[model samples]
Target: MEETRIRFGIMGCANIARKVSRAILLTPNTTISAIGSRSLEKAVVFASENHFPESTKVYGSYDAVLDDPDVDAVYVPLPTSLHVRWAVLAAEKKKHVLLEKPVALNVGELDTILAACDSNGVQFMDATMWMHHPRTVKMKQLLFDEQRFGQLKSVHSTLTFLAEEDFLKNDIRVNPNLDSLGALGDIGWYCIRAILWAHDYELPNIVTAFRDPEYHESGVILSCGASLNWKTNGKFATFYCSFLSNLCMDIIALGTKGNFRVHDFVIPFNEKVGSFYAVDNSKWAERALGCAPEPSELKIEINLPQEAFMVQEFGRLVAGVRSNEAKPENKWRVISRKTQLVIDAVVASIKNGFVPVEVVY
Candidate 1:
């Protein structure tokens, strides 16, 4: 039997969109139906250079892509400031939305987008690719193990990369009007997401932003850190994100009796495999010369990159809804809202003299 194909319309030609377009093309049940840019020539060039199918449409206005009857879903890679407007419109158009993260500048905008999707009966998902990686699932299995791993203790995540000269000067991420959240939105989103994932999506009771976030002259955050505590259970998590440091992506999670370290949590350095170092329990060496029990390196092979896996999962949900086989999954909306709420809390803490802010939702 032939399978149904979910057609995707891309809403921008941003650099990240180029990578996602490839993922859509590689997805088994998804196809690129069209791509739009503010300028017609840019859209045409993007399509040609990316070797898109001849049937793919090119449009000068975003509305054209949303209005296309062939477009069953839209992958939006627009700036953070434009997310609510376009995402809501896409849902209203009956097109499922695969939005790029930060998802929105704040939780209020995210709720507006989610409400539109719910009212219109469309699936909503954020493009946080790491969530779909096989390695992520393997790590979670270990975290859930009661005997091998004890109760969650603490977590620390860091993601940083020095911006290029042009990126530092002209990237939309650092622009006050386009993406005011800046590095916190562009880079820290992953760190926050990792922390929440490690905590089983539990909202923290308090969020305290680390003092003195680096800021651009335009009043946008370039780097920031925050600490979170989950009630009185003593579960703690901290994260640091920046555009001013050497390239690195790390997640160190410690449990009462075990621990693991993910050196490349965002995007694996090796295209074929994602790996981590783990230890269940350890003891001091004889005479206390050094540490005992070497950590084991675990690797998981992947047939596709994390992004393509994300698209495949999103397509599965959209296809189910299109076929009347299932309702849209609300998990995506749930996590995105949680992540955005924490982001809002961080911004509030920074503004309020780095005081601990109680998270309400």
Candidate 2:
């Protein structure tokens, strides 16, 4: 039997859109049916380059794409500042949305978008590609397996990368309004998503945040870290995100009886998923499983690369979207809201010169 193909329209001609267009092409039950951009020339060029069917329509305005009854779903890769506005509009048009990260600048905006999706009965999500990766599932499993990382104690995480020089200026990262979200909001977000995933989407009871305003104008957070405590129990988590350093991404956790780590957090390849280190004692050992890393408490030097992580991960997200199985708990609105609340607390802490703010769930 032939499956129903989800007709997709792209809301921008951004480069990320090109990645998604390729993924859409790769997706089994999806099609890049239309594209809209501020400039028709750019839209036409992008659509043609991606080999979106010649019958696919190209429009100069986003509204035109939204108005296309044929577009059942929309992928919005717009700047962080515009996420809420367009997502709300798309939902009203009855088009499901796959929105990019930092879902919105604040919780208010995030709430508005979620509310709109609910009112309009459209599927909506923030594109935290990490959530879609198989490694994410594996990591969570290792955490709970009685044999590994039992009785988790503390978590430490870091995500940093050097942006390509040409991609720096006038980009969304540099725009003051859109730029209000820094490394934490931008990349550190993965850490929050990962942590929440490991904990079954439970919100931490206490959250304290800190931001480096000097590194960004518009009071954007440059380097933000949070110490989270779950009220129901005595579990604690700490996460760090930075933009002003060398390119390294990883997470390490210590449990009462074991330890676990993730070498490359962003986009780990299939082969790198289980590569990790573990110890029941205060000693070190390194071993590699050629096919896939062995399950252990401490996962380290997991050699997963960039495109391998995000591309296939996004493909899974698209698949979930097509199947109508995308959940609200995993929605970007929920993740971003938790993250923004963390950032808001961080900024308050930093403003008082690093005094900890009480994190409210």
Candidate 3:
């Protein structure tokens, strides 16, 4: 078989796309063939600044990009609500899709996109860049070991950020229609993903949650918490996330035998490494890794930019598609379903006054 270079056409000039576009540029095998935006002027400016070859098309509309027979795949960094809609349309156009996080507002919407991808024989993956991290897999290996956190007991995770003043002014994150799920959708999704990875817990049998209406002033949950109950064995875990709070990011999981913690789990900005700590025999003894010669004070510098990881990984995904190894065992559908399930329950719980909700599988 001939070596294939997955040609890409970016779907929007959104901020997220800026990161992804940079990533594509950094990676060697993937070629960005076109860029699209609602305005031709924006597309032209983006393409020109990025040094896209003259042959590369500057599309004024999404449909025009989709219509390009030369465009084999699309990177959609649109707003939260448009994820499912555009993903489905991209797949219908027979383009492989790498969509940003919170792939849909809910599971039902995710299902529709999944169906479209299946029908069109196109690969669709969620752009939860963190999920594809090398450290994530190693962390999962530790979590799955019975010797690690045997019989998970509880989970505590958080992610938050203060928006830059300039960004807060015009970003869609400030728009009610564009971001129905404020910080919860943006930051909370990672917390939920980490919890599941740590516990190896599938969909929770039951979930109950609450949103701070004060934080919900943006007409959405800026901060949210949820308690999850596992059906397989009645194992339970709790997760909390907020954008309204001061900067904080971490994931701590406690088990019957021991506890494991990850410092600054979400943002791997800079070359700062992330530390993973485990205490098995008891609370007194703690073993650390990822810092220096030894695991000392549960601190690891995760030195990487948010966009750097995603860019390289997207190249890998494109290669996988060409080689027919595109079927990743852990697809975004699982997390999307689990997250939407938890979010739906949380919404219900808040409306019903924090009453526990039994989630439908």
Candidate 4:
């Protein structure tokens, strides 16, 4: 039998890698070929615990996985600081790269990674699972309808989860030397991505960080909020991300004639089914006595989870490249760059005394 499935080598044993490993197995055209960690023993335990196939190789170093001839692609779940180094190495090895989000610490690093992928002719995609949810497509369709949604006016997104004491003190996200962007890089990435997706990836003209950003003693951001504005059309967006609040993921977009809301914009509350609410031409009746109609609840059901769908889409792209049928899909790369550019603007706004920062492309 010809081995047509894309074999993936995982470059880390982070907790999030477990979910992605399951996603790889669930995706039809993908398989977990290798698991790598600094400690070979840790890699072995991770593969066994994650129920990887017996043929999955365990390696002590990330470079070993990249050097493996059988690895057609690599999933990089490493820390933000390591993304550029390892992802670039993987691409240089001619392996497709599926990187986890907050793709990098800044746009400069992301561009470096993208350049490597382009030079090597390998697929590049950030692991933003929600982008693959069927519900997202449905919401986008509504947003594009001229009469149904009108012109986009404003968007507000929030994603916050209370971190445990131990995590607040020791998690990589709070470590300045590791995931230095902190909440903005971790949870805020999703919020930024959602806002961009709502706007069809249009780059905002200005970003202003909300005045009172919370920070850890280590100088890492613990919570923050920002407002984005489009000068040409006057469209605006606001997003808040924190590590000191109760779990919440919400995206509310208001248009001239309608509104749409998604309670779970990052990870759905239900793995198999996702939902959203939308309303068109909503109006009050009889001097604000009552509303004319309630928002419609739309549910999207899928055979596989969103992460698995992400893996499936990435695998298909890699397969296309392997068969010489198509080039690497650049859509995901473009989206990722735009998201990072907004994030960079937010960071600049925060650094420049909460002043508005102009987004440069």
Cα lDDT of model 1 by residue, 168-227, tens digit: 899999998899999999989999999999999999999999999999888999899999
Candidate 3 lDDT (Cα, whole model)? 0.72
lDDT, candidate 4, 163-201, per-residue tens = 999998889999989899999999999999999999998
- By summed lDDT, the worst window of 10 consecutive residues in model 3 runs over 288-297
Model 2, runs deviating above 4 Å? 1-3, 164-168, 210-214, 217-219, 269-333
Off by over 4 Å in 4: none
All candidates' lDDT scores?
A: 0.93, 0.69, 0.72, 0.94
* Cα misplacement distance, residue 102 of candidate 3 (Å): 1.7
Q: Tell me the lDDT of model 3 at 291.
A: 30
In candidate 1, where is summed lDDT lowest over 10 consecutive residues? 1-10
Which lDDT tens digits does candidate 2 get at residues 1-361? 1145677899998887887777666555567678999999999999988889887999999999999988878889998888888999998998888888777777778788888887876766666666655556666776776664677766777777765554355557755677567676787777776666666667776666644433654455556677777766578787777666666677776776566677766755343444545554443344532322344443334343333344444445545655678643355456657766665666566668776677665
What is the alpha-carbon lDDT for the whole of candidate 1?
Answer: 0.93
List ranges where model 3 is wrong by over 4 Å: 1-3, 51-55, 164-169, 216-218, 232-234, 283-330
Candidate 3 residue 107 Cα shift, in angstroms, is: 1.7
State the TM-score for model 4: 0.98
TM-score of candidate 2 versus the correct structure, residues matched by position: 0.82
- How does residue 228 of candidate 2 score in lDDT? 76
> Candidate 1 at 63: error in angstroms?
0.1
Per-model RMSD to reference? 1.0, 5.3, 4.4, 1.0
**Which candidate has the top score in lDDT?**
4
